[model samples]
Target: MENNTIIKTSLDPRSTFDKYEKRPLINAVTTESYEPKPQAHNSKIIIESIIHGFDNFRKFSRFYAFMGLVAGSFFSSLLAVDNLSQLFPTFFNGYLQYIVPHFFMHLYIVGLNQLADLEIDKINKPYLPLAYGEFSFTNGVITVASFLFLSFGSAWMIGSKPSLWSLLVTFVLMTAYSINLPFLRWKKSTTLTVMAHAIGMTTSFNIAAFMHMKTFVLKKATTYPRSLFLATVVMAIFFAVVAMAKVFWFCVSLLEIAYGAAILIGASSPFLWSKLFTT
Candidate 1:
């Protein structure tokens, strides 16, 4: 419709045909020459890519969820306080060794899940790096692979049996939950999906982290103290909510309400008993 656009296109045969066909976009985008921006040095490109990779890793990994895992590990370790003096150096050193590899394992699992659910994520969680196209699929594969390598390699290097088992089982369950391969992709099955996450969270996060502190960090014999009930509470509170996020918002809300009510009831029970006994 603009005189400038029509006059410009009238000169070029290709543009003439486009006008003859009455293309809507003919006037929409001006025929501007496309030029590639000046190339950065190869080393610069590599550095930028590395920076993007780290940013993508941060985007993909849930820091709050990861911190919850860390908190679980921290408290579980406290459950195994055999000797106060051991807390000074031995416990701190051993906890770091367990945590470092676990962090890598956490990245691998979350990254792998995002990679596998790229298409679904565009619908469910478009803000995710992979879904948003900020992180390419090829780079996702590379990052996840690197995390997997670091997870197991560091665990083995430290010669920690608890960390080894922790990473191993978590890897297997996460693979089952996310990968699209045959007999995998447990997310397709309601039963398998819940089972995978329940076991993964309860066992890998709850038991493994607890065991790491009890055995490796504190050098204590494996014993389930009353304090270890904290792990069970964690499993009950967190496991289903995350795993069931796929299913129904109602269920997630229900679990939250139930947990909140339980906390209130637990807190009030002592006062209720005092009234009963006094009466």
Candidate 2:
């Protein structure tokens, strides 16, 4: 009877409740309030931001652009080949020399456009990295700058006059299109936008033509045929029309116009026809 009385006294309900209640407060004041050191925490944040930045960059569809560039390069090289014996060599060499550099060039242009359009994107594309606060503007700028550097640097290494000139011209035009500081944001006006796209597309096609011609020259063959020139012009016009159509149309209407344009261009260019048919 004495032991039972002692045990009941020690097991007081109020005391147990007090002890249990104090534990959470103690944890709140100590462990719950504790933070990891700033160095590791900040490093983690920086790494995550970089990862998100790249994820945002991939949203630009870089792989598709890269593959398109590669295809263009290969197709142009084939058209430039006057003889079957030189085909494989020209195709391989041009692909090796041109595709990587052009990919970076296109990437630079895309990054600049995104950086300049952050505010507009908030209303139009809130899910974008900058609009959603996933990528800081500073990091975005750094990324664009890095792409610009890689593009021009790779072109210089290639040491091709056409590649260098094309990169330079494209860079200047894209800067005018995206940068507002010098009052050259052509994206504001539909006319200017179409004009810019026209010129940009023309220049891009010319770069492929030039690359093709370079490959032929290296093999001591005649320059690219007049057919190649015609094909390039038709393709340029097709791209320009498609770009304008995108600004004006939506949904099925846009697809109809784009497909119609593609069909017309394809019909006009034996090179494009052959390539498409072969594929």
Candidate 3:
């Protein structure tokens, strides 16, 4: 059979072997079809997983983000001084007073928020990177320490109050308001929180006034120029109104909306949209 298969060789026009002096050609081997396997790992997939991990962490750590927002708000208040001068041309420039107090306020607010949420965090916010065991305790301590040092150091740099005593007093008040365990629990109580809010507003307005008053004093200007007195009065009233509004809104405003919705629609109505009014 092998001889028969080899003996019937014939030259063909289409065959390259016939044109090339009858050289023998090997047949191709074909056992089965195969495909190459992909690489063990894709670089793009690994990088995407890392990015997704960070995004997930950020979404879970809102309290830390809130602390950052509070710090930004302090800076916002500091810049508001320029705007305030425009509103009241006679405004005194208490630059250090306004800026320092707010820095301290935000630092303490952030620390207190974390402390206040310790319990709630243990329950509801455990997934948060800050509250969870993701960041080391030492890291959190360093972060808080850095914030406090910067805040108080800046206060010392530009404090308007001539006495270190006054600066120390202000720092102590803020720290106590924020940190002391039993003596003054400001964050825990709604009433205390609202009171602190009023105090904060008062401090901000006074800082504006202090800047103006100090400028006038430096210039040896006459006793409290009467022209700006009406504006100050209006501003003080406005501050008071705003404080009350904030307090009211903080307390029963949501409940009020729920009641109003019940009256207009039904008791089962969702309050998601209505909650914006409170905010």
Candidate 4:
């Protein structure tokens, strides 16, 4: 009887409610999901910013590749200037001084475009930082302004007139291309947009690059080579076409790449024929 009474007492429901006897409540702590601050330039933000800023990193990569080839295919200038083993390093150093600053300028250019095209991008390219709401308008403004200041300031510091001019001209062009204010938004006008983009991307970039390397690196008088002129013409059309295709088609297909290749080859054929005849 005593044993049964003890068992009954231990089994009491009120006793089971003792806090001390309670096992740690499984998942007792309520978990709340956290959404990141929209404009925070934290790790995720920084990564997205970089991805956006440096998107199509090839935009400027060809500058180096083409210029490097122009300077020398094998440890010397096409004119056979020697001591290039040492001079090549010098060339790269100067190139970086000029190109690195322009990188920030490129960032500003692309960011400004995004700011103006947020709605279109949401439907077309939602992964963009601003389009997806990861970046706010204020954040976009601040970042774009900072990049602009950095690019302009650094170009001035480099003391290269060609470099500074390149940044200035490209900025003005891109600003005009993307800004929505009256008389400035070239994107609304197909002809104006194409003209501005082609000129800004091709003539400005190529001519400025040639001037920089020639005057700054080769230490020579500014002279435009035939090949350089040819390059600008071809690349200008290519860039314009690509821009249109990308904006309208939303992607650059392999067929477009093959088309570009054919264009390049066909465009060069005339020059090749003339050169062959002359040589």
RMSD of each: 12.6, 6.9, 12.5, 8.9
TM-score of 4: 0.62
TM-score of each: 0.69, 0.66, 0.44, 0.62
Task: Point out the higher-scoring one by TM-score: 1 or 4.
Answer: 1
Which window of 10 residues has the lowest lDDT sum in candidate 2? 212-221
Error of 4 at 268 (Å): 10
RMSD of 2: 6.9
User: lDDT (CA) for every model shown?
Assistant: 0.77, 0.69, 0.47, 0.67
What is the full ranking by TM-score, best candidate first? Answer: 1, 2, 4, 3
Per-residue lDDT of model 1, residues 169-271, tens digit only: 8899889889999999998887787778777766655677678878877667888754455456546556767667765776678587656655554554456
Cα lDDT of model 2 by residue, 1-279, tens digit: 999988997799987899899999988888767688999999999999889767876775346655655665567655655577765765566656766677788888877887898899889988766677777889888878888899889878777666677677778877888888757998777677767776676565554545535542454434655546655665555556655675554434645654665556556655765547533
Quote the lDDT for 140 in model 1. 88
Pick the winner on lDDT between candidates 2 and 3: 2
Model 1 spans > 4 angstroms off:
1-54, 246-279
Per-residue lDDT tens digits for candidate 3, residues 130-197, read 56766555665565566666655765665434213333444454455566477775655555554554
lDDT of 4 by residue, 35-115 (tens): 677766387878986786675333312345344323321221222222566356776676677676777887787788888
**Candidate 1 lowest-lDDT run of ten:** 270-279
User: Which candidate achieves the best lDDT against the true structure?
Assistant: 1
Error of 1 at 53 (Å): 5.6
For model 3, give the 10-residue run with minimal summed lDDT: 23-32
